[model samples]
Target: METTEADGSLREAAGKVQQAAGDLLGDAGVQVSGKARELRAKAQQLYADLASVARESTLERPLTALAIAAGAGFILGLLRAASRQNRD
Candidate 1:
């Protein structure tokens, strides 16, 4: 009877330990998920900041730069056309 009692007590202790381990793992998973979300949000904010700066800063003003590029391309095309004709 004493041996059986000892075995039962051991089994109960093991069950309690398993439950505690499961709880700890669940809490750790929640913490990791929360941290991942926080990092992702921060990354998104950084991307937005960079994009806004690129779009609005004088060095990268989109429409003016685009017009300059188009004008240069058109001039190059005109030069190419003049250079390609046969003189004879």
Candidate 2:
């Protein structure tokens, strides 16, 4: 497994244990904190998975990757400009 996947798994396991402890002790704060940690770990794992896929795709098709990146950048720039106009 990748380092990020391993770390995320460990973090998720810790969160589960914390959540169970909170449930046994009836501590809402601990329960909420554990739940948040679990969610963050899941998100981290998902990001790692997506990054791996993106890396592979980029390697397999560099031109396609460049095009997609350019398109995404253009869209982000437009969104930023729109946000600035709204703020002004």
Top model number, TM-score: 2
Could you give candidate 1's per-residue lDDT for residues 1-88 as a string of tens digits? 2443445445545545555565678776555555554455455556666666665664767778688789999999988888886442
Model 2 spans > 4 angstroms off? 74-88
Question: Could you tell me the lDDT of residue 29 within candidate 1?
Answer: 59
Alpha-carbon lDDT, every model: 0.61, 0.95
User: TM-score for model 1?
Assistant: 0.39
- Lowest-scoring 10 consecutive residues by lDDT in candidate 2? 12-21
C-alpha positional error of residue 28 in candidate 1 after TM-score superposition, expressed in Å: 0.5
